[model samples]
Target: MSDTPQSFENFKLNKQLLLAINEAGYEKPTPIQAQALPLALAGHDLLGIAQTGTGKTAAYLLPLLFKLKYAQGKHPRGLVLAPTRELVLQITDEVNRFAKYTDLRSVSLYGGVGPKSQIEALQEGVDLIISTPGRFLDLYNRGEIFTRDLKTMVMDEADKMLDMGFMPQIRSTLEVIPVKRQNMLFSATFSGRVEVLSQEFLEFPERVEVTPQATTAETIRQVKYAVPNLKTKIHLLEFLLRQQELKRVIVFTKSRKNAEAVSNYLGRRDLGEVKVIHANKGQNTRIHSMDLFKAGDVRILVATDVAARGLDITEVSHVINFDVPLIYDDYVHRIGRTGRAEKDGEAITFVNPAEAYHFDKIEGIIRMQVVELSLPEGVEVPPTPFVEKQEYEREIDLQKRKENPDFKGAFHEKKGNPGTNPFKPTEKKRGNKNSKAKKNRSQLKTQSKYKNK
Candidate 1:
């Protein structure tokens, strides 16, 4: 532990753990893993600042599993709480991989399915539990979870947890657990809310940051296309997918509606095995879709921001932003889906005039100016639909007004502002034009007053 280890064998890990780590395809530790492993194995409370796909799951798991060697107790000795069901499953997969050679027993609890199997697994026995906050709370409230033996607690994607309004559940969880334990919190970005959570969660913790907060991966080649309409965006996506090298791709949309539309469009176009996942999809359906994508059955997976944070599917060739994310931090997660495991990746975003404003915010958060590319030839850039154009204009106006309260957008210009609009008359001319109407209003007011009297 005194010197930096170039390989996994250099770490003070058990024979069984080393075997599992080797088979799991880990040669050397990721930056987060490298820094956090020693601190965590030394029984220090760890605060890991890392985005998704940085091998953070293993960062906490390696040290955690090393300590829980051979699984002695009936109740869970380690508990990892994540924001979404997908992430819980993801962490569970890694735990299984890393603990393959050990006698460790881990159970994953999530929503979308009945808890019968999970409760049965718990009743039998488990050394570790990976679960979503809501599902974990549900099980705990029903007297299903035994936390008396929980020596280590990990909260992954803490920032996303706050965004999803899991703070109350998280607070309740803290009260229920044993007062003394080793706590670890990992977040992609440490916003104010995450900082507050960290203050309450960690006690004299060792902070390990593998990357700057909210920064996108440098390995990703990012490009933005100024699309005029949804149809044009679809055309551009088709154009990109037509290329033979885009073997595995994930198209991230802003909503379930858009995800479905894009998926359906691709499916009909005979684009290789397209599937979509969002909140509207059943849990089983979503899981099945993810499995298909991971297994190479589905070449294209259209998703909303739900899959942005923690679902780890490696070697994803491209991440296409069909719509700019509403939350700026999500841009990091969306692109982080690619460029995984330090591999070169590509991210292409389709931004209309309305979305350009949000994309600009994304660039600001990532601290880099993304390259804007001209539309490829043969892809028809059709005229934007009237309704869509109006919506974009309205959105742009709202963004402008949000930034500057004094902004009188082109759509909302005062009718009498002469310089602002060529056809509009001066204020004096407007007052003169309405002078007769003003007198009529005064006469009506006097008549109404007399009537009241």
Candidate 2:
């Protein structure tokens, strides 16, 4: 072992793994690989704290491959868990690439489609398993997967898994696996929650932090625009896409509806083969969209947070946040899609009035203010509609109420004010009530006069 394994050869990896690494065009060890590989190769449970695109994948993969040189028995010896289907597929591809020269077999399991093929793959036998928590657990419960021979378990994007509320599944998976197996957890951000998870999962694990947690990549140039509303954001996005510098881009929206809207708008405008992906999209559709983007057939990809974690496309030139992520930590992951592997990239955020607060939180988390760029001259700056404005104000007030229980939001009005109740027809109801009262009084007076006569 060398003090600084500057090159891949310095690690003394297996010949087949080395050959595959070389063929994949990896010249030297990344900072994470240089630091973590030695410990991982020595069979220590590792807690690697490194952001996406820091070569963390290779840091763990190389050692695991080296230890499990070839396919052993029918059951898998190595298990890797990711948070998303895209990530599972990405990991599967990387596993195939790195294990090309060896006889190792890998299978990826995720829930969007039928599990028939996945069950078949598991039955046929594999050396490695890359999967999402739910699908893997589903198959396991059905007696489709056998984990008796599992020797290594790697949890990639551990923080995202926790954020996605997969802790129970992770725990259940842990219960079924052998307690004597090696455990490895890698995450971009090591928050308190992740630390707690590590305590339960790892045994005296060696902590490795290549970069500070919740920090954005220095290679990315971040900029922001304060648009009036969603329509203006769309206009500005179109204007930006017209610029030739934005060659390959991913536009991130907060909701599936927005993702589809942006993708359809770009497609209608002929903005260079736009494709949309979200939870609603079919499995094959999502895979095909990603394939098109990766192959350069599509210039733009519109996606929700599903694409924010563990998507490893290195050639992405730009990341546009069509809507600021409500969860501040997600901003880091969204921009991370670009600025990967020491590459220069740009991340532009479109902040509408409603999203400004969320954007501020993101800036606070990143510890840097994004340079506010003026809206392009040609783009139409429409006035925010009353409905949209009220919605924005309502959301802002809700957030404030969360921070301060005594705070009254914009939606709050005097308790007795009928006008404040939007759902009630105050004017119409009031007039009808007065007219009915007057008619009843006249009828009562006439009935009294008739009785006296």
Best by TM-score: 2
Clashes of each: 0, 0
The sequence of per-residue lDDT tens digits that candidate 1 reaches over residues 284-358 is 999999999999999999999999989888879999999999999999999999989889899999998998989
Candidate 2, which segments miss by more than 4 Å at Cα? Answer: 1-4, 406-410, 415-427, 434-453
lDDT of each: 0.90, 0.90
Q: Against the correct fold, how does model 2 do in TM-score?
A: 0.94
Q: If scored against the real structure, what TM-score would every candidate get?
A: 0.90, 0.94
Runs with alpha carbons beyond 4 Å of true place in candidate 1: 1-3, 413-453
